[model samples]
Target: MEFETKYITPDIKLALFEGKLFKTEVMFEHHMLVWFISGETKIIQADATHIFGAGDIFLIPRNQLATIINYPRDGKPHKTVAMHLTKERLKEFYTRHTAVGKLQPLQKVYRFSKHPLLESCLASLIPYFDLGDDLPPDLAAIKIEEAISILRSIDKAMDGLLADFEEPGKIDLTDFMERHYMFNMTLDRFGYLTGRSLATFRRDFKKTFNTTPQKWLTEKRLELAHYQIAEKKRKPTDVYFEVGFENLSHFSYAFKSHFGYPPNALFKDRD
Candidate 1:
């Protein structure tokens, strides 16, 4: 199956939030690294709650339930820069190294070690987040690659220190699907990609992502469609084809179900 990878420009996504902020439970479809550049927020994961503050970095693996509770003090909101990575791009860094595979979910809530090299690497990520709107696409990608390399190095070192670290199999599957959802594929094909049987993929996929493959694919398509409509100013027909949906009717139904309204609802003023 052929796959088309999408890159989100840094300027379009990089944001700082503050004040009393609360977000509903959401599932992240890509690997994310969040650094609390300042202030504090309460992060709730499936089994634990963490109080995050200055210099604290947190990793949220793909397709997991999470909530962020932000309480600002003195009218100042918490600040953060969250970096999102597509799985296919991240796979490029892990290809030749065994240790790369061992660093799947690095969810630490404390300060990183005082090693100068690691500190410098973490400092470099700030510029990636600081990319201006007019920055060239190639240059932005190069910056992202540099940041990923530094992060991978830190992850490798941390994984070596912690022997009990284990990759979450469900998260692995979710990341794979997010990266390849545009392909014309079947359950058997997905299983083959992951070196598993169709039956096993079905069983574990639901166990990990809390949904079936079809449901997940439908959601992924809708998300891409929404991004195109809202960000790229693309029409519904164009989004349907671009996101690999074969029929407008199917796309409309899924879009409505996912976003609680019809696609036209998003562009009624123009209509």
Candidate 2:
């Protein structure tokens, strides 16, 4: 599988990804708006999975973890254009548009229901992708504002989601860990997200979960992987990395150590 992703700007990315099915765990540092041009994606959040097809648009809030499953559709490569709104850019917009409204409570991910205005706005960005040249930052910024305007026309909540330019505060550790155990990220990242220093994070983690963070994460992921292979009939190779193990070898070893058998044995037992 060949995957090509070009960053048209620090904030805009054009991706052409194809080949076999693959999973990517993304912890978004910036709020992202995605326009799907071809193929499909299954966006798995902590609570729900969102399926998007060609011409679909969605917005993901910053500081959220999502696993994206990308695969070919009708033998065509998956293509998507994503616009990222950095905190600085969002702050600028918030200042420029004073009446955008008090921040509206919003979900972590918002899927725009079918709307012509939103579709048209996404379509307008295609020409820039086709230009084969760097997208001018000013023009890209204008497009971002245009997108926000279109979304606002659809739902006023867009104002709060886009205009409130604050980083996530210290989140609940239990909730965050329960939602993000599958993500392969550093312990430091986990600490930061939960708003703690590394040492405090470890100390607090032991108090809350009664286990080290690493051990808890491994057990949690392994438990889920066991269900997928034994009950759901998923392939071990497919399930291993998705469960947060860095490699098949490590996963296999750990599975055997924990379950007294390899993942393939679970599949065999299921068979």
Q: Which model scores highest in TM-score?
A: 2
TM-score of each: 0.47, 0.89
Q: Give per-residue CA lDDT, model 2, range 195-259, as digits (tens).
A: 88899889999999999898999999999999998778899988887778878999999999998
Worst 10 residues of 2 by lDDT: 98-107
Clash count of each predicted structure = 2, 0
Error of 1 at 42 (Å): 1.0
Q: Residue 128's C-alpha lDDT in candidate 1?
A: 49
Tell me each candidate's RMSD, in Å, in order.
13.3, 2.4
Local error of candidate 1 at residue 181 (angstroms): 27
lDDT of each: 0.59, 0.80
lDDT of prediction 1: 0.59
